[model samples]
Target: MPAKSVANAKGHSAGFMNFIREQGVVGLAVGLAIGTAAGDTVKQLVGAFIDPLVQLIVGSQAGLKAAEFTLKVGDREGVFAWGAFVSSLITLLAVAFVVYAIVHLMKLDKLDKSKDK
Candidate 1:
């Protein structure tokens, strides 16, 4: 390889590293990964435990996820899956609560760099 090309590549590499550090890209990436895992965990918990309880209360023979209402109008039929929506909403709330709890308990919010005036 030419010396000039090698130097340019090194400069680009250094610039990229500096960008990552200055922008907190690594921390953002780690947070995203952990958040995804946490969301999945909460979904599983809701699906396995909370969903069944909801199903029992809703009295859906097909389970909460499959529970829906069918509306017939003339020759048209519309199915409204309210149960699925409720289940998803529950999952979202659970994930948000879990993330909030973790951040609060661990004081992770304090680690952020203060904004410049």
Candidate 2:
């Protein structure tokens, strides 16, 4: 390759790497991966432990996922599965809490650069 071509390639690579660093693309990707794993873990924790406790508190044999009521209107019945909604809500809350705890406990939030005024 010509010297000029080699210089241009080097410049392009440097620029690309600079863009990645300045935009925090790698950090964003890492955070996304960690968040996904944390969400899955939190869901399992909620399902295995918190869900059973909720079931005991609510007195539901099948747990929160089976806590639902049926609505009857003029021979028409509609099954409203509110228990599943509660289960999902609990999972969401648990995931958010876990993420918050991880970020704060590790002080990851402080790594972000302050924006220029």
Candidate 3:
């Protein structure tokens, strides 16, 4: 019984390793790290470059220069930070474009390979 259990465990471990190998673990890890770094870089760019450009276009009061606005709700008043939302939207668009470009390139490469064969 003990020997059978040991063999089963070994088989399970081997299967798991085979699954990782088929999925290209090294490539997956490198891509994930690079993508995360790129996202952070984009966020910074939106905050630094896009924010100022937007502020210049919309004026100091309506744009990035004014980070928040006051809203009145009956007897209560609240502040809304719209600049952060603008920055976040810019970052999202940048990341989407990057991913789209990558996928487009990959599809082109695949087509080229099929043509060669």
Candidate 4:
């Protein structure tokens, strides 16, 4: 390879590394991984406990995760599965609560205030 081409390539690589560091990509990646795991854990928690209680109210044998209402319009039929939507909403709420608890417990929210000074 030409010397000039090699130098340019090296400079580009170094710039990319600097961008990653300055943008906090490593911390974002770690937070993403932890958030994914925490979401799954919260979903499981909801499925295990909350779903059954909701099922009793919805009265679906398949439970809240499978609840749906059927709709028909002039012989055309479709089911509006609000149950699944509700289930997803539950998952989102649970994940938010779990994340909030973790952030509160770890005092991670204080970091923002410190940075403001």
Which is the leading candidate under lDDT? Answer: 2
Q: lDDT per prediction?
A: 0.80, 0.81, 0.72, 0.79
Per-residue CA lDDT of model 2 for 1-117, tens digit only, reads 999999999999999999999998998999999879877887787678766766677767356688789999998999999988977786677667766877799999988867773
TM-score of each: 0.63, 0.59, 0.56, 0.65
Tens digits of per-residue lDDT for model 3, 1-115 = 6999999999999999998899879878988998798778766766676656655665663545358899999999999998867756765775676566766867853543542
Off by over 4 Å in 4: 61-108, 111-114
Candidate 2, superposed: residue stretches over 4 Å from native: 1-27, 38-61
CA lDDT for candidate 3: 0.72
Q: What is the lDDT of residue 22 in candidate 4?
A: 96
Candidate 4 lDDT, tens digit per residue, 1-117? Answer: 999999999999999999999999998999999879877877787678766666676676356667789889998999888878887776577567767887899998877664546
Residue 71 deviation, candidate 2, in Å? 1.0
Clashes of 1: 0
Please provide, for model 1 over 16-71, each residue's C-alpha lDDT reduced to its tens digit, 9 standing for 90 to 100: 99999999899899999987997787668767876566667776635666879999
Candidate 1, superposed: residue stretches over 4 Å from native? 44-62, 113-117
Distance from true location, Cα of 77 in model 2, Å: 1.4
The worst-scoring run of ten residues by lDDT in candidate 2 lies at 54-63
Candidate 3 backbone collisions, by pair: none
In Å, residue 43's CA in model 4 sits off its true spot by 1.0
Order of all candidates by TM-score, from best down to worst? 4, 1, 2, 3
Which TM-score value belongs to model 2?
Answer: 0.59
Clashing pairs in 4: none
